[model samples]
Target chain A: MATFSFAVMAVLPLFLMIFIGYFLRVFHVFKESFFNEVTRFCFKVAMPCLIFKNIYSSNLDVGSYVPLVVFGITGIISLAVIGCLFIPLTVKDQKKKGVMVQNLFRANFFFFGIPMITNIFGEEHIGPAVMMVAFVVPIFNILGAVVLAFFQEHEGKKRVDFKDILHNIFTNPIIIGAIIAFLFVLLKIPLFDFVVDVIGDIADVTTTIALISLGGTFKFQSAKHNMPYIIRGVLDKLFLVPAIMLTIAVILGFRGPELAICLALFGAPGAVASFVMAKEAGADGELAGQLIVFTTAFAFVSLVFFIFILRSLGFI
Target chain B: MASSFSFAFGAVLPIFMLVGLGYILRRLGYFPEAFVTLINKFCFEVALPALVFYNIYTSNTTIGQNSGLLIFGALAICGIAAVSLLILPKLVKESPRRAVLAQNMFRSNFILFGIPMAANMYGNDGVGPASILLAISAILYNILGTAIMAYYQEKQRSGKKSVHIVPLLKSIFKNHIIIGAALALVLLSLQIQLPNFLDRTVSDVAKVATPMGLMAVGAHFNFARAKADFRYLMIGLSGKLLIAPAIVMIIAIFCGFRGPLLGALLGMTASPGSITSYVVATSMDADGDLAGELVVFGTALSAFTMFGFIFLLRSLGFL
Candidate 1:
């Protein structure tokens, strides 16, 4: 019961924020363009600052968490490989296969995962979770870009811009933030208190703004039309992936907060980036959008269940 | 004295640096024109509101405590508006230009510049009064600006004159700054403490508003257009940053307003012409170019004028 309440407490504010975004959109308080721009700002500016601050402040020892790091990387890569192989076989449409595959593997680690971990473990003990982000986010981006590029609509007419892909992956704001933060931590550089305060301020609103924008941009009409694909995508993301990943981690002797972090990494909603990548890459943007909405809507139940089970088993 | 000068300089320099960086980044194509607009929108909608809300909500001071400062701020704004309305018409002949000039002279960029400056001077204690003053001043400027524009516009169109109260009220209510302040005040009154996560999230996002706002101000600075309307521009700047503030400060000091209250007033009175005045002018078919020039010049000159105010205030031991 305690774990259940904790999960509810953790997820409630996030949903409320999304609802506010939706209300604002419906009431014409915020225009669609405003939501888009704010989301981009959150992703590019605020999220990076947050990741950097979290990792930089953490007393992370890379050498100590080698097993967990190895497990996380292996889990994501295998999930991507499995998604790539299975999605194409099931989905007849070429454009949709890539998006589905991408959705299957890429969790909302940046938005949902980090905040969830912080909630469950508290801020001081989230070093391993931040480390997971540092490893998972870049890999997710690279794989997402590659998958989108592979199944781009005009594949025969236009060659894929490898430079753009590499640039996007390398210059990704979250990745850059993680790298800079790692350097700061590794080199033992002391940041000014005011600077840290300012960064902390910027980082604080990232999740709230992102969640609101997610709600604002949500298309219920699209979900209605793409119900089957959305359900499949949600099941794959919210259930199958976490189930496999957490079991693997538990079997590998991972326990407590480590397992909790794994659950967050794997069990959260499909990333909003999937929709962005789909639209940009000319894949099935509608399906991707629906996937995000459904997964997000159902994520609370899944998160609560995971926490309850983990707590009951004394694994977290 | 030297230490005070350094302290004042340290408080003000980061703001200028961010603005300068914004100008350079925009010039170098690092931030596209669309991106600049987007950043401004985000600041106004999300960041600035959050900052105001958080500042006011977290403040231990009550509205009753700062009622004097609030009343003084309202009176000062009204005084400036009245003076500008009476004097600006004689200086600028065209009715639209007169209205825009009058509005620009009285309406300072209080939110972007004032709160931060006050906070710098008095730390956390300053923010409470500054934010309250911001809420009051924002409403005053909007209503006064609309009335002036409407009066002139009516004269130009059909010679029937009355402020469009409905639309004006709609705008005032819809304003994110006003909404933020109002919501924060409500929360404060209710004794509601936001959850730890929510509070941290808001502050983080709210922190972006100052730097982003100053940078947007810098990025939007127009050199070419500013030179075109030098005569009217000078009038607007002097009225906004120098004459208006000086009069207000003397009165405030005489009224026993000292410390953060005085600092807050100085910060508000000494700010530049609001960027909103330019938007209002352009949309209302007034001398938007002149309004734009006033904003650019008024803002450019304000950095020095504001520093001088801070210096003088500190020297007098008021801050």
Candidate 2:
């Protein structure tokens, strides 16, 4: 019962906070353009800091998890296969195929996954979770992009430039964060902690403002047109994918913090990456928006149900 | 519960404050163009790199039994993502926009969102491995991901493709962030530490980067444009935020990733489309608007898709 209440308390406030920002925007308590700016902040500043701090501070064994690494790479390969199988059955647009390939593996581990995992498992479980997120996400990005480009080439279209991939992966802020941190760890070089501490000190404002700003962008009316896509998206993301992940985790004997964090991560709502991908592919941005709204709305219930089941089974 | 509240509050409050304030200032017309440029440059060139460098300089390494696992684990994830791009297209009829959509669905936001969140969750321990994986991903993205994009464009034009090694090497060297990262690594390897004054200055500058960047983000909404390009965006969003992560998870399980590694792998699986994707799209002239929409849509949808993924992982005791 205590755990149940704890679960509610953990999730409710987060939802409430975002909703409050949303209502404040709706009521005109704040100016309308706030969300756009906040979203910008999240992209430009806060998130980068978050990545830097995480990568730098952790003490990790980059070589300990061969099995896990192999597993992750194989997982991406499977995503392509799954996407290929479905492509023929349902959709046909080449760009949409590219989009499908990307979304099949893009997970949100930062805000949603971290909080939920920390909430349920405490701080101890954070390290491995972070490692998995850092390593797997980027590989997913690069490989996913490559696969998309390959399909484009097969159609006799202009392919994604190999140079672009290299430039993007290596020079990217997050990837840089991962690399630099790893080197620092490997070399045993110690810097004055104040450097990051100062940044860390100011970090909280970035995400909060972004969330509030996102709230300001909320337009209930906008959701009307993209309902079908949103529904389908929710079905695929909030239901089917997670169900599949759970079956796999159970069969594989994952337990404790690993299980908890994985579940929390699986339950995370669609990331803003969907919108980015849609815009890049010249797909329906509105559909992406609808997915965000719809999935976020449903995630509350799904997460709660997840917690209940986990606690009942003594998993948490 | 209290701890969780405090943790969340700690994470979000500052963002709320800065963005909220920035919005007010923007509406007041207090932010000049020069100011915006300065802010962007500071965030991008100096502060951002410092943040990355500082973090890297502080981490601890794990190299024994864990080494093989990290390498193989990353390889597996990369392999899967590549395979997805291939397979997804086969399931659907090929079309002109397939390249863009496939890229959207397959790619992820590693640095912007994933790193920080990983930091907050795992601290230094997870950050170390995450960084290594990130490097591997970087190599893969540049070599494999970009190759695919280029191939598509070539095929669409003349159906003729050839490897252009010189251009690729030039581009690789020219990437600012990568260069910065490489420099930092070299410095770390050389055991060079910044002087206190320099360190303090860089750190101070870095400190301002996040809040300022966040403010800039707040001012960057394009609902009007997004609304104009709804359909194509939705397709991209669906592929990226939904299908992409689903496929990754299945593969991860089949490949036997479990425990914290599995959780982290899954965590990475659901990231939204990266801004880097936008950069690549623009450079290649493939569909920038579509890329932007994917970033937007992928980000928004992640809230729910992530939750569902978490729920499933929890039920299966893999959290």
Chain A TM-scores of all predicted models: 0.92, 0.83
| Interface C-alpha RMSD per candidate, 1 decimal | 4.5, 15.3
* Highest-lDDT candidate: 1
- CA lDDT of B192 in candidate 1? 87
- For every model shown, the clashing-pair count is 3, 219
Computed on alpha carbons, the lDDT of every model, listed in order, comes to 0.75, 0.58
DockQ of each: 0.23, 0.03
> Candidate 1 on B35-71: residue-level lDDT in tens?
6765666666666677767766765655686777888
Model 2 ranges off by over 4 Å: A29-33, A63-73, A92-102, A143-156, A204-207, A222-226, B1-319
User: Mind sharing the TM-score for model 2?
Assistant: 0.48
Model 2, range B1-319, lDDT digits (tens) per residue?
A: 2332233334334444444555555665644444454445445544455555554554434455566546664675566557656765675444335556666655665654445545555566546556655554544554444555665655555544554656555555554444555666677778888754345334444455555654544444356877976866766676666666677677777767665455556556566665455545544546655565566556656656665665686578655
Fraction of native Cα-Cα interface contacts (under 8 Å, chains A and B) also present in model 1: 0.09
Assess candidate 1 and give its lDDT: 0.75
Candidate 1 stretches greater than 4 Å from native: A1-5, A20-61, A81-100, A117-131, A142-168, A171-209, A222-226, A247-260, A272-286, A304-316, B24-70, B93-215, B256-264, B271-307, B310-319
- Chain A of model 2, TM-score against the native? 0.83
